[model samples]
Target chain A: MISQLGDGFLALAQPLSFLHLVGGFLLGLVFGAIPGLTATLAIALLLPFTFGMDVADALIMVAGIYMAGIYSGSITGITLNIPGAPSGAITTLDGHALMKRGEGTQALGMSALSSAIGGLVGVVILVALAQPISALALQFQTPDKFSLVLLAVVTVTIVASGPLIKAVVAMALGLMISTVGIDPMVPVGRFDFGSYHLVEGISLLPAVIGLFAVCELIAQSSIPASLGKAVAVATIDRPRRRDFLPSREKIREVGLFTFLKSAIIGVLIGMLPGGGASMASFIAYAEAKRGSRHPEAFGQGSYEGLAASESANNAMCGGAVIPLLTMGIPGDAVTAIIFGVLLIHGLVPGPALLGENFHVIAPMFAALFMASIFIFLSMMAFGPVYLRLSQINRGFLYAFIAMISMVGVYASSYSLFQMWMALAIGVLAFLLRTFGYPVVPTLMGIILGPYLEEFLRRSLIVSEGDPTIFLRSPASLVLLGLTLLFVWLLRIRPAVKRGRAEAAS
Target chain B: MTRLLRGQVVFALGLAALNTVYASQLLQMDRPFANGEPGPAFLPLILCGFMYVASIIIVVGEFRTAAAARESAPQSDVISRIALIGPALTISATALFIVTFFYFGYLVSAAVFTFIVSLFFNYEKSGDLKRSSLIALITAFTVTLFGWLFFVKLFGLYLPVWEL
Candidate 1:
């Protein structure tokens, strides 16, 4: 596996491919530094770029972008009050407060060191545990797979931010779209709607780009100027006397302690359906604060908070990749896209993981390691300089994003229709964002919907249409039972109590 | 209703309408399976049913909110009705853009199609010609670069490209 990964890296070492790594890192930095420009948006835009490239190069670029993108959010979080990414929201607990106290550079420095260490540690876990995780995945049967996907889809109904009805509608809409292409078991088209293009159903790249990125742009345009202004970053004239070594020593002490703690947190969260960097970072931040000697200093701007978030979030990189590489389950949105890439590359993640394809794991691990180091060195050399983009005008800003969206959509297969699709969806997404419909759940449903349906359908097929297939498989039964238990605890029981209490009142 | 509620209502309604349309599509579906088992349209109808019920619940909930609010303040209801128009126009314009995709071509069609879009939101500053056009040109160029360089040249799938 290690040699395979080395080969993957060596393949990427060419001037062109190596430049792609740098380009991707730089792209992540810019996107992460921007308050609303997210890794999701970046990857969506870059999807078109992949329409013409090798799947390996495309996957490598996006993966690098994703890893560094999660890490780079702290740069803005520490220097500016804004979190460049969702995962970095916790970093603002202490990062911005510390920046106000003239430790902006110091915080950024700690963020860099901790981010690198945390990412490296996470990669180590990925290397060691991926094989074991892959082995566990082999135990899954068709019934298990189907039931698991159901549990995943149903899990959203309980935890979605909006009303359960809205969540259900969104999920149902996604499932309907999933059936547009040729049916897996059957030969003829279902919802192709008479168009040859429809025979392929809705393309994942264009559909996702439209739903998330385009919609965001529309919402952004509608926002009042007050909401548009990004958080201000105080200038650092003295630059904290350049004390990174001291900070590193301090972080090393903390990193040594939280390394294991963060890895455990990341793994636990990564195994969940919606568990991604955001949740992992949040959990790690809470744990770090819980264990810190200076808990009072946390929200006010503690270095430990920064360390915890950067490390845990980056460590989440490995955790998120585990299911993707081994079991074909996507750990998060970004990995969901990676699942798309793996499928495009003709790698069926399940049985393929146990075979000679052990080669894919090593290269992915190595790429992640390289991407992390690149983020570290890149941030040290160039992160501080780009802290001033908040001042850019709205028209130009959205225009730039629109341009990327256009070029990216068109590039994704040289298709004008895809561009229109992006613009169409961007407009809708923009509206949705304005309306406060959480986009994440919908995206999650879209990405996971098909797999879940296939799983459920296949399980029924295997069981001769017995719905009890879910009950018969130990794994399926456990997953479904746990899901039901969670729903009862989180929603049904809580609602019941609320109803009783309200009646009494 | 706040802008949030209006959006939820519209999306819910739109999804309900989509379910009706998709269910129709499913009924018309060609059955290709040999086993005489449930075919492509089977689960799709189930899915549409799910969409319908979910949308109904959402609309009912939002409508209840709208009805309750009407007794307190009619002005908010009027404001919401007015605000919903902008999005309706925006979505209609998007459908128009998609419909005319081949005629407009990727670059020209998107620019003209969405120029009013950018203008509708950002055209108040008449004095800033350079910035606005620069933004427009950049937007157009983005269409070209992403379409040509990234998707067509690199990833190389047959997307819906437009040319002479």
Candidate 2:
């Protein structure tokens, strides 16, 4: 492991790998610090670019983007009242308050410091835990794998931010879409509907582009571009580079224990299916407030609250990658795109990935570690510029996204049909969002549907059509039980409680 | 029912209809249910059942919560009504740009696509054609040139310019 770590650093030290890291980090910062843009979009746009690069470099660049993007979400939250990303919303409760109190510099500094610590801890945990988890997962049978994928599908659907029925419908729709093209098991066409292009099935590139980039474009078009006016620049004073460094006294006040605890919380949340940075940060912030001596200071410029959220959200980057690399389960949309990257590079993300391709994967782990440290360096060096990120021209920005998204789709597949497919999915997604259906589950369903189907059919075939095969295997039984447990906890329990309360009232 | 719930009801019904078509198609496949062996249609058939059930639940839920949903419907209705000028126009513009792209090539296609998008967003913001068009033109040129260099010159990826 030590030698691998050393070799990882050596690989990252190459001139091209180093350049991609810096480029990806800067790209992530820009995207994360923009209100309507996200790290997912950044990576989605970068997908085509990665097609021509080495797998190690591609993974390394994605690593830099993931770390920097998750961390930079707080940059705009501290300087402006608006969070640049969903995960940064929790941080804004205290961060914006600190800005109003003339402690913006200190808040920004602490955010960077806590993110670095949390990120480092998360990476260490990821490295220590990923291989062990992969080894255990390798022991899984077809039924067990099917049950596991079922758990992921259900968890992702139920955790989506809408009605349970709507999420289910979205997942079903995605599964139906995945059913298009040729059938995986039978080598027969299923849902092509007489179209030649549909026979190939919808690829990940268009689905991702349409779901994120094009959906964003249509959504952004609804708002009058003038609406997202930044806070008055004159009110906030620019700080010197020295001011961007968290003072030792301030660090002592936040306490190292708070940082470590929040990071652990983040890592654990990230490991769970449907766990995301926003949820991690929110839960960690709440926990920090509960544990703080000055709970009242939370949401009113408490550095501890800011630290908790920033640390946890950044740490989630590493935690999210763990499941993706070890078990082929993507914890969130960003990791979903990373799954595509792995597939594009001829690397399948599952138990065998680590044992067979540890050399290629090591550089990404190292990049995450280095990018975490770079977060502090960037915060100190370019604190002022981060504040002005939202002020970028909207017309130019969306136009660039529009061009790159469609062009990227075409370039990757060399098929015009895929580009149209992207637009079609975008329109469908926009309609779904308008009707209150969450789009993430649809993307998840599309990505996981094949695996879910293959495992189930294989298990059924092995058992000679007995449904009890799923329950008979110990591992499969445990996974199925966990799925039920999640449904009871997250869905059934809430509905039952609500029903009882309504009756009593 | 509220406009939102009404829309959802229609959507749910539509989805159910689509699922029926999918199920019918599945039945057309060879050995869809060959005894004991799960064929191509097995998983899809299961998914179709789930889709139909979920769609029904959605429709039923909308009816059950119609009163509560009505109170919140007006706010969203205003936004969606405004979307005619906002998203509708932009989507139409994008569709037009794409249709023109194949015949016109990358330079003209990209420039026009960027120009229309930029103009719409800018005009929506400032409501000044002169400024919007100026920004649109510059944005169009820069974005088009960048796409050309990056995809064509740098990465050497193929993007059809002009079939005509």
Candidate 3:
């Protein structure tokens, strides 16, 4: 494993591969630092372009984007009080407060430093555990695989923000979309609606582009430009590179223990299906506050709070990739799209993937580690530039997005029908968002639906129509139990508490 | 009904109707467990039933919430209308772009689509027609050129240039 990883590092050192990493890093920074744009969107846009690159370079570039995108979400959050991505929301609580206190540069510096630490720790743990976990996963039976995918589907549905029913609806809609074209296990056609194009099934590229890029374009169009102007009107002071370095005393104040603990919490959360960066950072921030010597200082410019959130969120990037590479289950939108990327390259992501293709996948791990280091260096190099990222002209930004997304879809498939499919899905997604439905679960469902169905059918066939096969396998039993447990812990418990509070009031 | 409730009900019903179509297609397939094995329609049949139950629950919940909101406070129609114009225009422009791209090909469709998109954003931001059009023209040219270079020259992906 170490030798393979060494080869991965050597691959990254090659000039073109290194350039791909740097280019992807810069792209992630720009996308993640700008409000209304996300790392998920940037990666979705990059999907079509991956067709032209080597498989290793494509994966390496995606790793750089994933790491940098998660870290840079805090940049705009600290600067303008608008989180560039959802993962940065917890950071904004303390980060913006620190900015108002005129310590914005220092806060940015501390954020970058802690994120690098967390990211390195996540990569180390990932490298150590990935092989062992894949070995374990290789032992999974059809029923066990079905249970695992079910756990992912249900957890993702429950964790999505808004009413649980709405999330479920979104997920069902995605599963329905996936059911189009042909039956996975049988040779019969289903849901083709009498069209040859429909029989080919919806491709992953257009679905991704439509869900993110086109949907974002339509969503952004509805918001009045005055809101953006208001954000741009805020006065910002020019700061030099030296201003971004955290003081030694401040570093000691946050402490190494806080960084390590938060990072570990992040990795653990990330290992769970549907455990994303936002949840990791939010839980870590709460835990940090709980253990703080002065809990009241949090949310009032506390460096500890900022460090905790930043560290955990970046670490989550590595953790999120674990299930994706090993089990072929994507934990969130970014990894779901990464799953598409790997599939596009004719590489199936599963237990056998690592044993067969470790050399190709290794550089991605190295890129994640290097991108973390770049996060810290970038703050020092672009401190001033980062402050002004949110002010880019909306006209130029959305126009560029609109053109690339539409054209990119056509380029990838050379099919005019797919372009129309993308636009139609985009419109539907816009409606889904406007009505308070979360889209992440919908994306997850599209990616995981086939596996969920195939496994269930296969297991039932072996059992001769006995559903008890799921309970017969110890691993399947455990996974189903965990799924029920997560529902109780994440949803039912919270609702019961809310009901009690309401009754008391 | 309040506009908010109306929109929610319409959207929910639309989904239910789509589900009905999907279920109808599922019925056309071989039944579940046909020939002593589960067929292709097995999981989708389950999903169809689930979607129907969930949709009814959601519609009822939305109605109850709307009734309570109506008793408590008046809803704002003006804000909703103002918020909708941009999306309406964007959707129309994008649909038109797709049609034109089919007939006229990439170069013309891309340039026109980008021009209109840039114009809408620029005009919305500044509310100045002349200035917005000028900036939109420049943006359209630059973006279209860059996209061509990136997709065609760099990636070597074939794009239709002039179908007409």
Candidate 4:
């Protein structure tokens, strides 16, 4: 295994493969640092191109994009007070505060450093656990698979930030979307609405492009440029290269314990089916605050707070891959898109993916580790440029996005009807967001719907329509119990606490 | 009624309507349990019911909240007209782009589509027609060429150049 992993690193040393990594890393850095553009969008746009590339190269490029994208989100968060991605929201608390204190360079430095540390830790853990987890998952029966998918769907819906009803609605909408074409269990078409295009069902490419790219384009159109310009006007003095390096005293202040603990928290959260970078960072930030001697300094330019958020979110990139490669469950949008990339290249991500195709998957693991080192190197290389990312012309940016996304859909499928589908889904997604429905659960629903339905029907068929079969299998029982526990802990307990607090007030 | 409440009610009703359409399709399929095995429509049937119930709950919740707000204090119901216009314009332009792409092929349609998108954003930002048009024109030329190069030349994907 170690030798195979070494071979993975050696493969990436090839010039063409190395170029793909650099290109993807640069793409992710730009997307992550620019508000309204995310790594998920970058990968979504790259989906079509992957059809022409080797599977290993495609996965490697995605790895670079994943690591760089998660890390660079905090760049603009520190400098501009606007988090480039949702993952950077927690980092923005202390990051922007430090920026206001004329410590912007140091803040950026600490963010990159901690992110590198976290990403490295995550990759190491992924390397260690991915194989063992795949072995465990290979033993899952039909009922157990159904239960696991159920846990993912329920947890994602519950953890979504909004009215619980709305999340469920969004998720149901996605599942319905997934059910449009041919039934997974049967050969018959279900909900074609009498159109052949509908019978072919909505492809993942258009769905992803529509839900994120088209949705974002329309949503951004609603916000006036002056509003964004107002935020961008807060400028900082240009610092020299040396100033971008964190001082020894500051690193010591943040402490190694804080970085490692936050990173571990990130990895653990990331391994869960619905756990994402934002949650990982938020929980780690809270824990960091709880464990700090100077808790009051948090959200007030504390290095400890910034390090914890940056470390955990970047670390989440590595941890998020474990479930995706081992169990075929995507924990978040970015990983979900990566799943599409793998599918495009004829790679099925599952327990057998590692066991049978470890050689093909190895380069991706290597790319992720290498991208972490590049995160620290990129900050030093482009520290000044990072501050100016938000100042890009909206006209140029959105126009590029509009052209690439729409045309890319056509390029991949060669179907104008699919392009239309992308547009329709985009509009629907725009409306969903406008109505305050979280879109992530909807994406999760679409991806997991087939698996959930297949496993449920298969299990039922095996049990001769007996519903209690789920409880009979020990693994299934454990997963179902976990699902219930998560609902109680994530949803019921929170609502109860909120009610009590309101009554007390 | 407040705009928020109005929008919420309309959105909830829309969802309910969509669910009804989906359920109608599901009814045409085999029953949930067919020949002693769960059929294709089983999970979808469950989802269809869940959607109807959830949509009703959301509509009721919106009305209840609106009633409480009305009793508490008067509030402005106006939503930003400018905000609505931006999305309307963009969506219209995108629809137009699709139509043109189908008729005129990739090159002409892409140039025209990118021109309009670039113009809309630039005009929104600077609110100056002449300068925005100049920038938009430059952006249109470059982005159109880049898209062509990327899809056709680099990736070896087939795209219609000038079908017309």
Please write out the lDDT profile of model 1 over residues A1-505, one tens digit for every residue. Answer: 6667678778677776677677777787777767777777777767655655566677668767887788877766666677888878887778788778876766777777767777777777777777787777688888787776776677655566656666665666666667777877767787666878678767777777777666766555444444444556566653323443336556664657875677568666766766777778889989988998888877887777777877788888877787677777675667777766666667776645636566554545666788878766765676457456455555555555554565555555556566665665556555445544555566666667667767666766676667887788888788788888867976799889999999999
Judged by DockQ cut-offs, the docking class of candidate 2 is medium
Q: Calculate the i-RMS of every candidate, to one decimal place.
A: 5.1, 2.4, 2.7, 3.3
Instruction: Please give the lDDT score at residue B103 for candidate 3.
Output: 86
| Residue range A151-264, candidate 2, lDDT tens digits | 989999988998888898888888888889888887778788888998899999999999989988988887755457667432556568888888888898889999999999
Per-residue lDDT, model 1, residue A248, is: 51
Which order, best to worst by TM-score?
A: 3, 4, 2, 1
Candidate 3 per-residue lDDT over residues A99-213, each given as its tens digit: 8888888999999999999999899888988999899999999999999999999999999999999999999999988888888988778899899999978889899999999
**Each candidate: RMSD to true structure?**
4.5, 2.2, 2.0, 2.4
Alpha-carbon RMSD, candidate 3: 2.0
Which segments of candidate 4 are over 4 A away from where they belong?
Answer: A231-236, B67-80
Query: Model 4 misses residue A247 by how many Å?
Result: 0.9
Task: List pairs with backbone clashes in candidate 4.
Answer: none
True C-alpha contacts between chains kept, each model in order: 0.24, 0.69, 0.76, 0.78
- Indicate the residue-level lDDT of A310 in model 4: 91
Locate the minimum summed-lDDT window of 10 residues in model 1 chain A.
A237-246
Question: Residue B100, candidate 4: how far off, in angstroms?
Answer: 1.1
The C-alpha TM-scores of every prediction are 0.86, 0.96, 0.98, 0.97
